[model samples]
Target: MAALWPLWGLSPGGSFWQRFAFWADALDPLLLLAPADEIRRSRLLLQNSGKTLSEPIQDDQMRKAFLLSLSSVHPDTDKIIPVLFRPPAFLPICLPLVIVSSLHLQAKATFFSQFVFHSYTTGFALINGNSTTKAEEYSVQEKQIFYSLGAISYAACIGAFPLVFMNRYTMKSPLMELIVRKLLPAPLLGLMSAFTVAVVRSPEFEHGIEVVDRNGKVVGVSQKAGEKAVRETALSRGVLFGTTFFLPNVLTYFVQRAKLAKTPRNLAVVRMLFTTLVLGGMLPASLSMFPQRGEIKRADLETEILSSTEEPVLFYNRGI
Candidate 1:
């Protein structure tokens, strides 16, 4: 896995495409079902191999285990994130919710779907973020409930805005109506997704997460790094949800125009498939947009962090 990073251009400050390739391999859906014992063995093999350099592990089993552990385990916590919130399960769980959220259903159904989607995404964002090394400082359960409610409330109200608008006003032009119905949801959903992530992960920004040197030694807690981490996650999420929501609707529109699926049932099936494919592809791409192990220059960090470490470049876990 270490050797594969360079091959995939996954340097400390690697480009987006490099990050994307790493995610594509890491987020394989089949890995989600790996047995608990197998995962334990994989982690053990990785720990015992002691291969610290960029050279590839000689054993194929070790390499596979490395990838599995990388996707499933949180580096800071060293615990398996909840299965539903893990990256491997992201596409499978989110695709259907996103498809339903984008659909022009009754007002009640639309709000319900939007609420569920936001709640799930919020949980994912919170879990995948840089969790505090100190557990005693914050109330995890209380914060989770509070943030979840806030995100769902925002999503429900904003998500319903377009539908409410359409119902209240009669558009004279079919083109205008089409724009509102088809084109508006993508950006709106994208914005809401980003907002939910920022809100759910706000504690990290407020309290700060740990920053470490290149050698993985803790220097100090840095709020600046926390802010940057949240910002990057939010941007990637916007891209993920924005493109996922937008492309399927546009493609479905063109398909309908071309008479690709004559019947409503056929069209629904086609749209569902399209949504699945788009989300599967976008999820990895968006995840790769930034390095999971992010870097910060010594000067960019807080003054206390600057005093604590002389290393020119420091690293932190930028949660997936």
Candidate 2:
């Protein structure tokens, strides 16, 4: 199985059978059913010699029916759904993203260029929005602040995109295991990217809404003040982000451990480490330098500061 996985990850130009050999090997067992009739015939012949012919004949027919039902040859399509669609359709989406994201570290420009042209072209934007002011006049500090804020906002929005789509898709999948195995990674990365970006860009320990009364009395209430209201909206979403990123991998590890029984399995630690490294490194830095609403207005006052913060937030961790 380990040997077959590397081949499965291959995308080389090859014959149809060659290209799909790994999947074929993995699925062959499920596609082929045991010979129930042969087993039933053997049992029937043996029973007749010892017991009664009629009893053995009746038993064989019942056994055959049970086997058929288990294999889902009946009217309902329940049993066939898992084998037919879940693994075959879903794993392809996952493996490619893993490969792409993993390779981004070594071949940064090439990886990004390919992804932009082939996969993310429609979404990529070099310079978004209209900033009526010219780029030259602003000081470096001002420009840096402007870019940081934009990157966080963009990253957060991208992170939120998958949650919007996946809630319905998860319901449609035939198997929960298959969904967890296949549909994770990309969208999980999205939400993590959003949280990391938003948290980092947003000022540390400065969460609150600004309110100004009619008489010009200004008040800044902490996030704690409306904690319940925000929690009601964001609680499930926050859990979903952590679970999708961490839980599926954990489940997969245990499932493998159960099957292998004797193999060493301490990968959960490594998995957690990698996740922490990515979230900690990229998110915090990008957000810290991000601009406030005041900073953008001040960009008109100094161009150099605005340009310094203009670099991409995605540069740190490109959704691994």
lDDT of each: 0.77, 0.31
- Across residues 1-320, which tens digit of lDDT does each residue of candidate 1 receive? 22222211122235778667667878898889887777777767666665542344456676677778877776667677778888888888888889888787866788899999988888888788877644454585578569879887888888887676777785437787677678888898899999998888877777788877644567888888888999999999999999988998889889999999999999988888888889888888888888777778889988878888789987677787
TM-scores of all predicted structures: 0.89, 0.22
CA shift of 271, model 2, Å: 4.3
Task: Name the 10 consecutive residues with the lowest summed lDDT in model 2.
Answer: 311-320
Alpha-carbon runs more than 4 Å astray in model 1: 1-15, 53-59, 133-135, 169-176
Off by over 4 Å in 2: 1-143, 168-320
CA error at residue 216 for candidate 2, angstroms:
57
